[model samples]
Target: MERLLRIENVTQKFGGLTALNNVNMHVDKGEIVGIIGPNGSGKTTMFNIITGIYRPTEGQVLYQDEPITGMEPYLISRKGLARTFQNIRLFSRMTAFDNVVIGMHARTKTNMCDIVLHLPRKRREEKECEERAMELLKLVDLYDVRYELASSLSYGHQRRLEIARALATGAEILLLDEPAAGMNEQETDELLQIIRRIKELKKTVILIDHDMKFVMNICERLYVLNYGVLIADGTPEEISKNQDVIDAYLGEDDE
Candidate 1:
């Protein structure tokens, strides 16, 4: 398995409080990996560090074996890393299609001068971006609402829209933060299918979700965290049977 991303002894601190403590993990190319723990266990903090929202205080983050630590978020996105937030972050006033179009900006090659002058290259890029955005909306099953304002969609559709936007960024590796947070069982099942399709499309995904069943169903491996420390890293079956993981997150009676 080729390592696509690696967190090498990464640690984050806020004054005296350590949000992450020398955490070590790696995701292989095209793998679906899950990160689960109780709230404040540093799941989102790790995502922030990986996506360049926060630079780790102690270690390095490598993408495709290249050090990407302390890079700007946009730079990371351009390098094919994109993420969704735990809370839905959408352009509520914009059409879902437009929101996705904005995500493609990172990959667009048209210069500002070309865009300002409405040059041929800008026109061509705009056309291509729109087509790509529509395809992404369709992939997330939001094509019917492509022209609708993001805020008008149901919560589940909004969540899918966020995923679609992330896809539009041409990301090879996607970090999803609580993508299933507010979803019901049916919505979550649908989300699982969408994620499966994303994997089929050959993208690597690292998700932090509280839904145990959802994560277990979709992930190839699981990483359990407790109070900023990694407690277990194994297959779902192993994690389910691991006493430490059960005590920290899944209760003893979970099975």
Candidate 2:
């Protein structure tokens, strides 16, 4: 399998505190990988490093064999990497359709002159964006509510909308932070199906979530983190039995 993303011995520091220490991980093309760790274990910090929110103090991040460390977030996004925050980020006033269309900004080629003159090129691109936006909305099961304001959607729907917007960015790799954070059982089931559909689209996914069942069921492989360190990585079955991962999550028994 081809490696699509890699974190090579990454270390992140702020002032005197180390958020990530010598962490190494990788994701292959078309694979759904999960990063599971308790809170404050540097999971979000790792995502930030991958997305260029912070440059690693040591080592580097590579995408498709090219170093992407320290690159601007937008630049990295333009290179086909995009992410959703742990908190929902959306245009509260904008319709769902429009919110998704806005996410395609990086893919648009219309210049000021093209828009000012209303050229055929602009019209063609506008049509394409609208069509793609609808396609994505449907993929995430939001087609019926495409005209609703993002703020009016349910929490689970809002999370799915975020996924749609990320897909709108033409991202080959989608990083989702805590996607199942507040979802109920039914909503989480829906999310699982939605993610399977995304996988069918041949997109790679790297997600951080605290729901172990959801993570194990959806992810083909998992990476475990504890106290800024990578403790273990393997298939769900292996990880379930790994002592380090067991200790990290459930603590060692005194008995």
Best by lDDT: 2
Estimate, for each residue in 90-142, the C-alpha lDDT of model 2 and write its tens digit.
Answer: 99899999999999998787889888897887989988999999999999999
Deviation from truth (RMSD, Å), model 2: 2.3
**Model 1 whole-model lDDT (C-alpha atoms):** 0.91
- Show pairs that collide, candidate 1: none
- How good is model 1 by TM-score? 0.95
Question: What is the lDDT for 141 in model 2?
Answer: 97
For model 2, state the Cα shift of residue 8 in Å. 0.3
Deviation from native of the Cα of residue 154 in model 2, angstroms: 0.5
Candidate 1 on 1-255: residue-level lDDT in tens? 789999999999989989999999999999999999887889999999999999999999999999999899999999999999999999999999999998888888877777788787787888889889888998999999999999999999999999999989999999999999878988998899999999999999999976678889999999988888999999999988999977876452332
Q: Could you tell me every candidate's TM-score relative to the true structure?
A: 0.95, 0.97
RMSD of each: 2.2, 2.3
Q: Each candidate: how many clashes?
A: 0, 0
